[model samples]
Target chain A: MQERTVKITNRLGLHARAAARLVRQAGQFKSAVELKREDTGQTADGKSILGVLLLAAAQGSRITIRTEGPDEERAAAALLQIVEEKFGEEAPDGLF
Target chain B: MDSSNTSHSRNSKLKGLAASPGIAIGRVLRLDERGRRQFYYMEVSAQQARTEIKRLREAFAEAHARLKEIRSNLKGELGGQHEYILDAHLLMLEDKHLIAEAEREIRSRRINAEWAVRNVADRLAGAYRHIKDPYLRERSADIEDIATRLLTTLSGHTRFNMSTLDQDVVIVAETIWPSTVGELDLNHVLGFATDTGGLTSHSAIIARAVGLPAVVGLHEITKNAGTGDAIIIDGAAGEVVLRPTKPIIRTYIEKRDLDRERRVEASVRSSEPATTLDGVRITLRANVELPAEIESLALFGAEGIGLYRSEFLLLNRLPELPDEDEQYQVYRKLAEATGEHGASIRVFDLGGDKLSLDGFEEEKNPALGLRAIRLSLKAQEIFRTQVKAILRANSHGKLRIVLALISTLDELRDAKRIIEEVKRELAESGAVHDPELPLGVMIEVPAAALMADMFAREADFLSIGTNDLIQYLLAVDRANENVAHLYQPLHPAVLRTISHLVRVAEKAKAPLELCGEMAGSPIQAIALVGLGVRTLSLAPASIPLVRNAIRSIDQSRVRALLAEAVKLATTGEVEALLGRQLPRQAPQFFAALSSLG
Candidate 1:
């Protein structure tokens, strides 16, 4: 199992497109992926768009991703990379 | 449905209308979805549970297949953002929790897949109801859409069968959606003759783009015709002949060939100025709602947007109506799209059978109740935000913001006062706006039409909304089927009202245009022209047809017809005069729209 605590850094928060990007990248791996928001304590299936939407992960909100399976490390790393990259939008001003 | 079976008009003709003009004769394909819903809930046994679960699995596969087909079809056709939205829906179909819940419903409750899918979808959507963020909650509609597909598929819906088309077909439905119109086999579709939609309906726009002969706003068309029945559609004439005899088919085929040539001629001549034979130029502006229609405006030779209905901005934006910034973004895009001609943007005319704004409760009689400027005045804050947005957007390009549904003199004054106050506040806040920008009133209700001089005196311009004016004058709701026949624009009262308003506008020297479905109709437009209405605003699809009607018409002939008709005793007599005399006077204008060989 691999775990990483990453804050949502996108300017528009984890909106429709941003959530879609996270879900799509997460679905590429074989690992069981889940995202838990720190404030709400609501866990969402990282590979599920609806689940990710339910997280209501706004900008500056911290979330932890836990992945376990054959592609655990890659899955965790890819999700963190997507969040850090701000889903290809400019970094939310204070995030860096 | 039964009445449609009995009432086949003379020559087997069914008069609907041509929203998008062309000609076609093909096998009728009845694509009706309304009567396919399940009503009864049957009890399921423990042994039957396994089969129910299989049915649920089948539904899942079908949903995914349908989504995959739609996604693949729309792949290159949509923007990256729209494509992402579809991908998110695709991901949702594979969501373990959603599927698992459906499985749980079947196993434990022993309900049918359709009911179980709907039940699960309702529960999921209910979760979204309390959320403060409108955007997040609006995503709930996506879930409902998927669930509808699941339920329909489980109920053995055969609506999505465009994958194989061996023969050319004409689609007949109550209403065909614009988005789904692309999914239909466009290459083989001879034309679509639907039972609903006006010239400006979303489906009509798609029909024009795809070059299909589309006749919308027919009555009980789906109930009248069946699959494999021969259909002859005169799209320009808005005529349909269902189950025609062999002789009739031969005649229609000959007519269809003639229509094809005429359509080509019309397309080439669409760019010419709409002027009468005596050299009176008519300003034909397009009534547009969506920004997508902006491109079509230039193609169809629209002078400018006569009515840019801003209510579309109020659709599905939650927690509140769209703020000033959001509205400014869309209005700015509209400004750029309009180029030199600019647009007449109506303020958000909410609260009338429209989606509730900021959780406004649904009214019993939405149309007559507090709506348009009435609602805007009460909801001053939202109205001010919208006013400021429209004013701010004028800096990008010229735009005239019009207030809707102004019945009395006071309502017009109240609106003007608020607009001026907003302008002053913007100036104080150091935001730029066109203080000299034109603001107009939509002369819809009878009171405004009667007091046309008063409204003309107060506002810079006026656009006659004959759709609402006729409906209000006749005390008939046009949408209500029971009263629809009574909603006549050719009524003696309606003509008198129009003539009175025209006379008033002329005396005041107030520049006004009739922007309504009535003006879009060649028959009604000729009458309006007779009443001295030079500037006519209509749907983009109707511009060429109306232009053709106007160009060949000598102003004196139509004036004579109007003079004779106005003195007629009844609506029927007036209509009789219109039906008889106008065709004789302007033979070429009627001939332009005719497909009859």
Candidate 2:
């Protein structure tokens, strides 16, 4: 199992578009992935749009990326990267 | 006007169609047409949830079809962007989170699919609303949309799915279709009131035939009705009182108690033969459809199943018809269920208006076209399969196969010949079957009634299907609301035809049974009994009322009325004669008939 915590730096937080992007990224890996809010401890399936949106991880809020199974390392790395990239949204600095 | 009286006092009386006749006061089981279900799913059992899962899947399929239709309409007229949204909507129909989550809750939490769907949607909606992003919050509307569609489909199925009732209660609905009424729980559903339909509608006919008290055409009753509001339905008076005052409720209770006492009194006669006052014995039988109805016959203490429609095997059985073995199983089940009492299995009466078989072309006027025995004869292989299967089943139990729609002597002869051929084939093959299987004809057409004597001379017995007889005799389609009034059972021509059939069948000493909606009515039963037609087969639910009607009858007086009934000029005169004579001769029967309305 692999886990990582990262702050949501997207301008609009973990909104529908960002959640969709995250779900698409997580669905690519052959592993069971989940997301949990650091503040509320809310859990959601990483591969589900509705589930990810339910985490309500706003901008600047830290969320934990947890993955398990044979591809947990790659799955956790990809999900963590999407959060760090601000889910393709334009950040305040406009830097990747 | 003879129906069960509740209390003399009444308030807020609402008139509707007198669909079914009975007196019932119960907590309302209202279905919210708006799909705003207020109930929770936590108490639903696993079995219920299992059904709910199936319902959810059905809702999905329904949504797919609806979305596809919308897309088809939006084709070319709308741009690609709208089509993309529709495609997404269709995809959401199969959303694992939306459907699978609801299924999980149904199994794990033991809640209904509707409630679970709403629950999951609510939680996700709450999260979506909490999200600071406007885009994510807007997605909540999509979840609400999907939830609404699923709930609508679930509610739609239950509105007509009468088998889901866990307890006896009055059904309060905005409107009910004839087909929906056909699917209701005949045994448990005490009565119903709808926002539409009149006395001659199919719902009313079925309700009256099944002996359920109903009041229809009560517009907006569903809006005011709740899940368990106390309701009083006066089917006889065509009135319904919702949330009645205490005094009115007390009066209804007294009325219901008295009716219950009378029912208890009637229980003793359930085991007795359906003999009238003059020692004229009658055979009270049931019209069997689905094989499961055999239990209902036994429950109602029916002497036998008179009209077991074998066509039910072919109708709606697309892709593949039941082979000889499947047909044999159903035939055997009915025969065994009937016990010592005989089972009459009508040959497949497919084609025409009933149902179209493979390769059978739809006719311009199906009722007058090739149907029943005509279609069976044309499709000899199909007819032979049914005959051979019936013969095979009779070897196990007391089963008699009757040929339906024998319009002419030639058709009867041909049908008889086929039966002989099947018998020979069975003999040559040394197959186990009833060798001496007696064949009969269903006397529905005018030609059959006219030749009742000739047919009875050779045929084993005759069952008069008055439903078809009256319709054909008057040249009126009883199902057509426009001509429904002309589809009178008391038409002078019909009474003469029935009187002739009874006299002929009696002189020949061949068995006879009147199996139709006509025989279900206490008033009509009196007239038929008076006409010297001793055997009556009708809906199983109507057995008690018909039996009570038969017991109350003085055969001698009815026989006298019959003599005058035949001399009557019009259908109105015949009705007037029976209406005046029945209540006077058999007040108890008339009172019971009042309750039947």
Candidate 3:
């Protein structure tokens, strides 16, 4: 399993729609993924929208991701890529 | 009275049924009484008293069966109060004492069967008039309807024949029921005007449902519309036109055609999202009262239902609790209607402007009184039933539960606990529903918005119920017409509160949506978008206008306008800036604002 922990820098925490977007991205990979929040200690199947919703990752919180599958390395990198992209920066227009 | 003394002496042409059991001066025209007779009528021979009783029993059975069918369909569509009307109909249909007394009178007095039926109806109607319940009082119509049908059957006039009604006649009546309104062919009918029934009454519901041009609650419409006289029914403005000039007629026809064309265009654009010039996509959902209203959801291009006021299930003298299965059927039907994007059912927000429970006396100040989640918390059984119903409907499509009037963390926690408990019960029972239903709260109260971050901690999402938020924040009563003008969501303080709440939810990473009357106003709705609110729930009628506004606005320009408006000192100042800037940058937004009044 490939694992890494990163502190959330986005001002808004990981919301349901954002989490859904993350889940949508994660589903693209042939990898089993899990996201565990440092604050709530809530772990979610990175592939499930409901699981991701339960994570409720807030700003300044640390989230650990574990990937295990054929494209584990790419999955972890892409998942990290979204976090680095700041959840599609500036609310992606009209999503209130 | 002499012919000249008669009220409708001027227009002697209109004709319609006596709907409200009173003499009304109305223009003569083909009127529909089909729906009134559909639920009643005795077909058995009057010679055999036993067979007549048997036929009455069968009629009662049919009424009971029909009530069950319409009850389930109309429960969530109209308010639960409507079903009581059906209940009264069923009670009168199976009135053993009334039937027995009428049977005795028929044998003893040797009265005609039709007169016997009419006599029973009159006594029952008189009894209904004595009843205190406004709902039961309306049931007097059901009695008259059934009696009319039975009398018609005996006379062999099975239908309320309108063969004498001529074309080009504007019919006027004291009141109209759905059945009577349904009989008039719109193709030949000029217009309809009535003195009774409120906006959501059966008459109005049918008028809007059938797309007829009707002006209701006009006190003397029937007296004014003279026969063979040029008359116009201003369905749009709720006005009546009499002896209108050729120019005026031409103008009305032009306006009517334009309105029809606009409605057609709106229906066409209903399925599309509100996307901006700069490619920003906004989810525009609809706030609906009935499932029938959902027909326009697709026509308005609603992303989904934002606020499904579930309190319609709790109103009236509901003898038993609304079961989980019953609630599930309603929610499932709504969810299915919205299709894949689904609906968000705001759990019953009862009290204040809503029906008061029989036991709970009126509060001194209902605005601050028990309402929404607060009332639900006090009445745990009612709350639990609603939670279970919503949970059971989750599997049909995307479903979310939104708790209203949440002002504190403890309330949120308690609500969350109740929802969790219901989920557990469903699990234990092996109820077939989506276990992971997303739960949220409407941030309507100022306290809720002020402490939105705390709510975001436990809740799955947040939708701003700005209608109450404005009323509560401004200390203004929305229903009171005096300070209704003061209820402005565009006020800097209100905007700041929304901004703060959105920022807090963003900080917590909780998805947020704004579903309010303000979200439909182009000026206020665009401002919310600039303040970082992306999802807007609006009335279906405003969808195309709002969608058109969003499409015309450039995000960068809107962003700049927001930055300027926020630094402003007052609501007036912000309005001034928007007035100057919006017209220049977004002409469509300015156009929508102009059309507001």
Candidate 4:
């Protein structure tokens, strides 16, 4: 298993579009990817947009990404990179 | 289960809003989710459970395919701006939690596939309901949307096969989503009668675009009618009759044929200018709520978009308004669509009965409370953002800014000050914009109407919103059933106020327009022209009939009729006079109007 913790830096955190992007990235790896919100202790499947949205991971919140299977390491890295990059969203001042 | 075969002794009639005009008589096709829920919980044996699980899987797959097709089709139509919405729906369909949970419920709870899916969706929706953020909470609607699609698929309601339907049928549903309207085959579907909807809903707009007769807000059409039950819908009268007797059906059939013949005659002359027989020219424009409705303007021979209600863009994204870029894109589209003819974009008219944003205090009477320009002035940032967008979009084509509900001169001046400030900022930033863009005031409040001469002097143009003006002038809420009868457009007081506005605008040499339900009605439209108003903005579906009415009248004669009308004491007196006199002057137009009854 591969696990890493990342902070949600985007202004509108884990919104529908952001969650969709996360799910799309998670689906690329042949691994079971899960996201656990550190503050609330809530867990959701990273590949499920609804589950990710239900996590309610707002901005400045910490979440741990876990991936297991043959491609676990790559999946964990990809999801962590997505979160660290704010899911390719522009800066806070930019229009959503 | 055989509800269609049930004896039809009780012939019921329902009254609703006239969403789209015309008539339709056919058997009903009940797409009622509530009715389907009754059979959702039926249990099954292990052997049947296997089949049910397979059925569930197939439904998910089929729904996924249909959504994919819809997404691709809409890509070209909407310029892929709303692609993310459909993308999320497709993702929800294939979500592991949704699919696996349904399968698990089917096996362990021994419930039918429909019940299992519904159960899981309800639980998730409940969770979403508890969300603290209003924007995120709104996402729950997306879940419900997908679940409805799955349920429809599992119940063998094949919305995808509507194009191949073997018989002409009237669609009876609790609510018809706009996306579903895109999938409907107009050739097979005669009309739409929904238990819930309004005249301005997206579905109703599509129905009008395709010339389908629709009566919405029937409240219980689905409960009263079933698949294959005889149904008759009179859209103009806002009447829906279920298990319609032969006489009722015959009356509607004749009315329907007359409506069709009249529509064909009107369309043939739609390209001609709306000039009175006496040679006075009148410009007819469309009141648009959505960008999708832009396509219907040219088809209806609308000169331009008169009232682009920008507030609709705020409805879906409330709590968080659409950013400047998003608003700019929509306004640019409107400007381009209208082109040289020009378009008027009304800034956010939030509050009132239309919408109450999150964190707004509950008012005792919202209609009279802080709304329109009042709300916009209070939330200057929201107002500035929309103004900035409109100004930026003005570079694309001819566009005017219209401020709504400017009851006081100070409010109009304040809004104009904000627009000027925004224009300065845009110019400083070196953004492309039209510095000469016109600013208009919507004369809706009784105070504004009484002070029309002052507003006409200050504002570049004046557009009378008769709906709210009459409601306020008479102290009658049109939406309230008790006092709705008193919400008269042709009341003597309303006519006098309008005539006052006309004289004031003419004296000021300011362009004047009227955009309200009264302008859409043939009788009231003639009265408007008679009152000296030269431009009218109405629904796209109403343009043909109103144009035909305008072409049929002699303006000088109607002006004389108006002189007699304002002297009348009551609404009934004025209505009787117009009803008696208008027919004589415009026999063909009155003939079409009488046939509607």
Interface-residue RMSD per candidate? 3.3, 4.6, 23.7, 1.1
Worst 10 residues of 3 chain A by lDDT: A87-96
Docking class of 3: incorrect
Q: What is the TM-score of chain B alone in each candidate?
A: 0.70, 0.71, 0.64, 0.74
Give the per-residue lDDT of model 4 (tens digit) for A28-76: 9999999999999999999999999888888889999999999999889
Rank by TM-score, descending?
Answer: 4, 2, 1, 3
lDDT: the better of candidates 1 and 2 = 1
Instruction: Report the lDDT tens digits of candidate 1 across residue range B19-38.
Output: 67667888876654433342
lDDT of 3 at B255: 65
TM-score of every model versus the real structure: 0.62, 0.63, 0.56, 0.65
Candidate 3 segments whose C-alpha is farther than 4 A from its true place? A1-96, B1-246, B314-321, B588-597
**How do the residues B1-597 of candidate 4 rate in per-residue lDDT, one tens digit apiece?**
223345575468899878788898887865535422322234456876788888899999999999999988888776644577888899999898889999998898765677777878888899999988777898889988998888878866422245434578898877775435544566888899987765554556557656688998787676677667788888889899888788877877888898888777777778999999999999999988766689978878999989987887865456787999999999999989999998999888887767667777879999899888898899889899999898899999999989998889999889888888998999999998887789999998999998989998899999998878888899987655445567788999999999999998988899999998788888999999999999999888889889989999999999999999999999999999998999999998788677766
Q: What tens digits encode model 3's per-residue C-alpha lDDT throughout A1-96?
A: 898788777665565335545776787899999999977687878876434544557668899988999999999998988887776654553231
Q: Highest lDDT: give the candidate number.
A: 4
The candidate that wins on DockQ is 4
lDDT of 2: 0.75
* DockQ value of candidate 4: 0.44
- Higher-ranked by TM-score: 1 or 4: 4
Better by lDDT, candidate 3 or 2:
2
Q: Count backbone clashes in candidate 4.
A: 0
First chain TM-score for all predictions: 0.91, 0.91, 0.87, 0.95
Better of 2 and 4 by TM-score: 4
